[model samples]
Target: MTAVRIEREIERKYDAAADFALPDLTGLPGALGEPEVQRLDATYFDTTDLRLAARGITLRRRTGGTDAGWHLKFPVGRGVKEEIRLPLGRAAKTVPKELAGLVRAYTRGRALRPIARIETTRTLRRLLDAQGNPLAEIADDAVTGQALDRTEPVAWHELEVELTAGEPGLLDLLDERVRAAGASPAGSGSKLLRLLDHR
Candidate 1:
């Protein structure tokens, strides 16, 4: 096994929440509002009992369009989380060993398995500036979740805003527009948390 220099840290949850709205790149002149589109798929993961409730770490194998792989995301800040994706391998049921060590602080050697599954249908909008460079990506998502332990299916709708690699002010600008659109921020850190909660 390759030993990667892993950065370990803990994230605290807060009460702040809002709705996200940005722009859709696929729809340029038309924007995301012109024609509504949706991308649907399910995410699977494993977690310890208490960890699922508190920390919300999800280890799952995902198959979809461009981003089909194993994803682990740690909560970072408000409306932001650090996401890491590994290529999918034969070990679909077990968490990748490389990633398992990364979550060692939370798992403490406990075994992990699929505890929840989440299905999401996302409507995307791409935001850009006058220069035509991508400013941010806005996704309006309808989510359905299944918790394996409790056999409960929950559903909700929320907005997501992902920033481009440029000035921080751009995100602030988009944030204003999103809030103006009457969308409130949804908590749970990242998509990974939503997946864990479903399980």
Candidate 2:
């Protein structure tokens, strides 16, 4: 019953990477300005043995500001992931079946559960084009994460700039400005993976 697209034609890969950096476009209207750092607590889920990982997929239930819900982020391309959101529910410890079934191609009927918990303190800025269209979003994040098997905390800071629907060249233009702002690129390709790694 889910209207989600199958997209079987999409190719899958095991090892892919990209450089991520904070976007700098504070001068434009609708740009996100220095966001007060906020602590974000989230839990990531996957099949008992990571069936989703084998297929390059990620499913997580997160609670935070305006966007709290079940988020399923599918790998689309380098530096890009398509995020699907569902309404937040009462079940904080389990992945919603509605969202999980969408990953059947990857999970193959395997069970999914909590694999990690991630905590992030995010500082955000918004970038916009001259026409007031959102060109990109830049975020500076301080992350601390706890994996299921480990007790020690992992900490790091990263810059992330997500592009809006526009010319691809805009990313390059933004990247130039971001690098000039003294921010270096981070390793992961997707925000979901970065959060999951820490969780």
Candidate 3:
């Protein structure tokens, strides 16, 4: 099965503290929901020499959380990306045939191998409008990364506030708040990129 999504994920990342307190989000469209917690483990695949990462493309197999499967994300434009998701059935560490075919142009006969693994403990707080519609989500994540073929493990904490059904301006509002609560903006492309850079 093939599924495509036009994802407009506008968010900011910040350096997290051990005892980080999230800023008040009740001032948003509606109010914040009770925090929902989950653990996410994702392994990213890439060609040696990092061809895919150089071109802002990412392929990963992730388990846990609301969406657990294989995802191929490619940059479409600034702050927006296109994601193609394939379900996990009998496939193990091998990349699914269908999903692999989609990135043939990038692989170009090269092998795709696991480059990095990031495990995160996420706390999700849904921001809703007065009509009970989802506006955005605030994710506070504590991450541990293990780079493939490498021995050292890297660990860090980050906060992401992604706009869901909310207006783009909501991110701006949230960014201001998160900054006030002492979060420094992250400079990496994604969690995978951040993990690999430490190597």
Using lDDT, give the best candidate's number: 3
Query: Which sequence of candidate numbers ranks them by lDDT, best first?
Result: 3, 2, 1
lDDT of 3 by residue, 93-195 (tens): 7888877898888889898888889899999998888787788888999999998879999998898877778888988888888888888788676888888
Worst lDDT 10-window in candidate 3:
1-10
lDDT string, candidate 1, 112-193, tens digits:
7776676777666555566666555566677777767665677777766566544566556655555655555556665546
Model 2 residue 92 CA deviation in Å: 0.9
- Please list all clashing residue pairs in model 3, or write none if there are none: none
Please state every model's RMSD to the true fold in angstroms: 5.7, 5.8, 1.7
Order of models, best TM-score first: 3, 2, 1
* TM-scores of the models, in the order given: 0.72, 0.75, 0.92
Give a tens-digit lDDT track for model 2, residues 1-199.
4344222111111111134444445544454544555567778888778777555676777777556777787777666667777767778887777887788777777778887777777765555555666555555666667767667867666666666554566667666676675555654554445544554
